[model samples]
Target: MAKALMIQGTSSGAGKSLLVTALCRIAKNLGFKVAPFKAQNMSLQSFITKNGGEIGLAQALQAMSAGLEPEIHMNPILLKADGNKGSQVIIHGKVYKTLKPKEYYAEKKKLWNKVLESLEYLKKHYELLIVEGAGSPAEINLRDSDIVNMAVAEYLKAPVILVGDIDKGGVFASLYGTIKLVGKSEKLIKGFIINKFRGDVEILKPGIREIEKLCQKPCLGVLPYFEELSLSSEDSLGLSYHKTFSSEKNKLIKIVVLRLKYISNFSDFDPLKYEPDVELLYSLRKEELLSADVVIIPGSKRTVEDLLWLKSLKIDKILKYLAEKGVEIIGLCGGFQMLGKILKDPEKVESDLKEIKGLGLLDIETTFYPKKITTQAEGYCNLKENLKIWGYEIHMGESEGDLNLFTIKRFATKEIKKEGSQKESIWGTYLHGIFENDDFRRFILNKVREKKGLTPLEKSYSYKKLREITFNTLAKLVETHLNMEKIWSLIKL
Candidate 1:
């Protein structure tokens, strides 16, 4: 069996995921085969594996950091919130069922078994497994049925490193309290990692010493905040921290993404943040929507419900006005469905409503089906002929329209099919991560720049290359700041 080490956080956004990602890369750099595992992940940001399995985006990125292909075993259970329909529970990367909080907790025993199976599978394949815990392990109300956090650590006999965000304040209290709350599992917590610290480590030394003394565990390290850290967030809680660029003299393009109540995969636009001339912000206000040079309706887990939300806020009217003004508007996945003339859900796959009116930005219609399309796709832009692009599809609706945006094929399949629709300045596609493609994204952005009477950028940075660089940077940061000697000792490396 492979050695395992777990990273549990003091709170939801206490930087557990990034620490695991860094450790995975650190292990890989030292010539050890490493992998990331999460017993359960409740996040809207997901990635489709090569075999058409859906897993959390954080695990996928961590697998990349470890120089391994993403697999379902990395994240055995994924819960996606579906508005009034409760949460969509995925077991082993396939949709299991949708259940409310009470209903989900009722099946704790069964879910725990599945987590064990996945953990065993990863143990046999990799030399080291860096496990990430969800929320806080200190939830006393949830400890009885917990499948993640301390439960998984105890199951694998893995040493746990609890992390607390110093930037959130109460770091010492949070760490001390978490250890006290875990009860018998406190023995498994070998150390504490203080993350997102700003200013002098010398100033924090006294507090760190006190926390160590109180918890009877060493303070592994104090990681400084990295404003330039460009990894995809695990969930929506990190959305507010996204940089809002001012439409200043240097920033030419103002891209506004609608912050829907049920937004999923908002990280689809993360690539745009690297562009020097572009400014990105997520907002739902009518004034903000109307002021954008480019407006994007991102994917949502609950499409029909979010569309109704848009209507209630009168954001639907704003979108139409923007469309009439020739402002560039784009929709992705569920957002693509909302841009159509009508949406029909006869079997009620997504919602109770049989039919709902869309924004009518495109001359298209969508019908929800029981089966979801989850596949990696490659294609070329029809507008810029032969400009190749590739991305994954994760949607339950099929759109019918006369206008087509790209010619594509599913991975390992040769059947050519038309995907997406474009009419004038409005574009809609089911492809997630479309903006990650440098050539195609630049083509679309340059077109908008030309219309605004600004010079188009001749060259743009490669997002794929940037991701590799980011992984290395994170690994270097952890290695430099943290006591790797203690970390390796815990894993028996």
Candidate 2:
């Protein structure tokens, strides 16, 4: 059996994911075989494993840090919100059911067994397992059906560390209240982490000592805010990080994404943010769109509902004006469907509306189907000399169009398909992570640069290499601030 420790938070967005990732890398550096496990994850930002199975992005990054292949056992259950009262539930990397809050709770017992089975399987292989808890362990209304936080900690007899965000204010109360609300489960918590501390550590010492005295647990350490760290987040809560960027460089290309209400896969543009000649922004204001050299419409969890939102806000007219001004426009997944002439939902898979008019930029029509296509793909993009590209597809609707921009081979299959559509300055595709390829990303940017009469960048950026450097940077940062000796002692029997 593997020794285990869990990082639970006072609330969501308390830096639990980042802390787990750093520990995984630090443990791997000490010559221990490590793995990351989360009993359940609720996020639209997901990754496809080598076997074409889906898992959370944070777990995938942790797996990379541990020098191990990402697998289905790492994240046994995933819940994708459908922009309604329900969520699409995935068990063991496959779609099990879609249920509302009441219906999901009705099946809690059966799902608990499934979670235990996955933990037992992962324990047989790794020497140490770093577990992450979702939301909060003290959610009073959800404690009875909880299978992710204290439930998993009790099952493994793991030591717990409660983390609270000081940036959100009232850290002392939040930490003390969380410990109090967990009742008998409070004994498992060995210490507490105060994350995102900004000012001098001396000012916080008095409060920290008081908290430790009240809760009967030590304050492990206070982690400073890293303003320069750029990594893929697990969900849209990280969207606040993508505000304004005022670059003084000459001829900087500004790319703005139309931040949808139910945006999914926003991490698709993380690569673009790192480019030397690019400045990425997400906006819902009309003034922001007028300054953009290129406008991107990212994937949405509910295409029909979001499309209606665009119509309601009159952003549809703004898109047409931009397209006519010779600005480049790119639509991905649900956004691609919005570029078509019509969207038909005969089965009402997404909403109550049977059909809706599209942006009418491309001569394509999409129909919503019950079965979704989820697979990894590699292809040759239709640029000058055909740049090789690779990405994955996760969507419910397929399009019928006359123009094709890429020919791709689906994973674990011999079949080929002419996918994606392009017309003049507008391009639409169902592939996410299409810009991860260095040659392909640079080629697309060069096209825009040539049109704007700006000089093209001589060197291309490698996203894969940048990710490795980022993981190491984070590992070093945590090692400097955290109490590693105590952490190691707690995890050991």
Best by TM-score: 1
How high is the CA lDDT of each candidate model? Answer: 0.89, 0.87
Model 2 C-alpha lDDT per residue in residues 393-481, reported as the tens digit of each score: 88887899755889898884646998899998899898898987788888888888888898887646698888888888888988888
lDDT of 1 by residue, 370-424 (tens): 8777888998989986799899989987899855898998873556799999999
On a 0 to 100 scale, what is the lDDT of residue 101 in model 2?
86
Residue runs of model 1 more than 4 Å from their true location after superposition: 240-251, 412-415
- lDDT at 425 for candidate 2? 89
Clashing pairs in 2: none
Clashes, model 2: 0
Which 10 consecutive residues of model 2 have the lowest summed lDDT? 240-249
**Residue 231 C-alpha lDDT in model 2:** 72
